[model samples]
Target: MAAVTEPLLRTERMALRQVTRSDVDRLVLLNNDDGVMRYLDWRPPTREQVVAEVEILLKAYEVYPRHGQLIAELADSTFVGWFSLAVGADGPAAPELGYRLRTAHWGAGLATEGSQAMINYAFAELEAERVVAETMFVNAGSRRVMEKCGMRHIETFHVEFDNPLPGTELGEVRYQITREEWLVARTSR
Candidate 1:
């Protein structure tokens, strides 16, 4: 798969674009929300951390556009969340789909919308053979998003974490969908 030069994609009700330094404040707030971080590994990130993360994402665009980060924005320009399609540490051929959304946006289906966009981009533009996503077992919301985006549960795996958050004891679930599966599903629909 080749890198994606374009930094933004539009959805029905949102825009997915590369993160910018200007997004720091909103991102910090989103990351800091305790409700939003419940399934995450750490507490809300500090302002400096947010800035550093945004810079890292920007740099990733240059070196790895095929597997980079994107910010989700509402039609009216509100920063809703961010998503990514990146190669997993385990291998280069497999890309992982991940997303984080503001707590207030939960249950509205924005996660599914944004995720489907990335999944489509992976299969259509990047020619990805497959895409996968993982979430803490207790994070039902995220699990639902993955299901809604047409991914099926592949497995539940346990991994040790130094400072595991609540529900980590339940392990984690991995979901996956292949390009062939996506194509067949779309044709059926």
Candidate 2:
């Protein structure tokens, strides 16, 4: 039998574990929700798209250990959603935080809870210089979560999507928290 590895991160209400092939079905449902996808892909990702993405994420785990998407779940194993501290071309020194929760779990502070945990991991464990997150300018809820996690608005930039979603005209916003800022906030809390 395979040994059960510990979760990558944990919070008061959830555990974040590495994403697995088995998570595809749950992820498909998450990627399909209208409200959840509203500010994201803007179109539901088909199963094939989700599957291929999962395969890539799985491969990334082998190469980049703890820097990728993770499955967030309750203690009882109920799926909430996913959170990520993903590396871009700039690599692991700076990671972008991202998340999506089930609409059923909306308004419960789960997004904020999970985000705070990810930021902590980025600064404390990863020794990252900075952490960042981005969302559509009109995504008030996401922006609020970033604020609550001690990130500050850093930029507003436009991207020309081939087919833009409504409110794309307002552009997108980026939020960031530096290691110094995170340390100060950590001490104050």
Candidate 3:
């Protein structure tokens, strides 16, 4: 396996790069906006919280680059959001994929573009056996992105949350696509 380092990934309209401390203000704005965070854990984070989060993300890069993280940016270099492919906390090697985007960037197919790129990297470069995604059932947009990435519905599971978001009562849906499935789909295409 190759050492994971901050990798610069290009998509149709975005670039995925390492998140930096300088991104605090943009991250704060993205997190604070209720529309953008409707499916997330908390409301927008404080500037301090954003700073702390950046530190944690950066540290993770040092410890695990390939499974680390990436910040999605526009061609002009505006921060759109972030994406990650990391091992689940549970005792499994299956990589969990996730993304967050600015509300303004929604409905533009950017998520699908960025996600597909990550999916390709995971399967072809990382040689991952499978990739998985989860979203609150009501988050139709996110579900669509996962489906578009070729991940099919796997299961729905409920996990208790202290201060659950508006859609938590709906439970979460899991979606997955194995490398074999992906290859078969690609060959058929």
Expressed as tens digits, the lDDT of each residue in 32-118 for candidate 1 is 876888888577878998889888887876877666778787766777888889776744346899999988888898999999999
Going through the candidates in the order shown, the clash numbers are 0, 0, 2
lDDT of each: 0.84, 0.91, 0.81
Best by lDDT: 2
Ten-residue segment with the worst summed lDDT in candidate 2?
Answer: 1-10
The residue ranges of model 3 lying beyond 4 angstroms of the native Cα positions read 1-7, 90-93
- lDDT for model 1, on a 0 to 1 scale? 0.84
Off by over 4 Å in 1: 1-7, 90-93
RMSD values, in order shown: 4.1, 2.1, 4.1
Model 3, residue pairs in steric clash: 31-44, 32-44
Cα lDDT tens digits for candidate 3, 64-90:
676656888876666788888876663
Candidate 2 per-residue C-alpha lDDT over 82-141 given as tens digits, one digit per residue, 9 for 90 to 100: 999999866788899999999999999999999999999998899899999999999999
**lDDT score for candidate 2 against the true structure:** 0.91
Query: Once model 3 is optimally superposed onto the true structure by TM-score, how far is the C-alpha of residue 121 displaced, in angstroms?
Result: 0.6
Which residue pairs come into collision in candidate 2?
A: none
Sort the candidates on lDDT, descending order: 2, 1, 3
Cα deviation of 113, candidate 2, in Å: 0.6
TM-score of each: 0.91, 0.95, 0.89
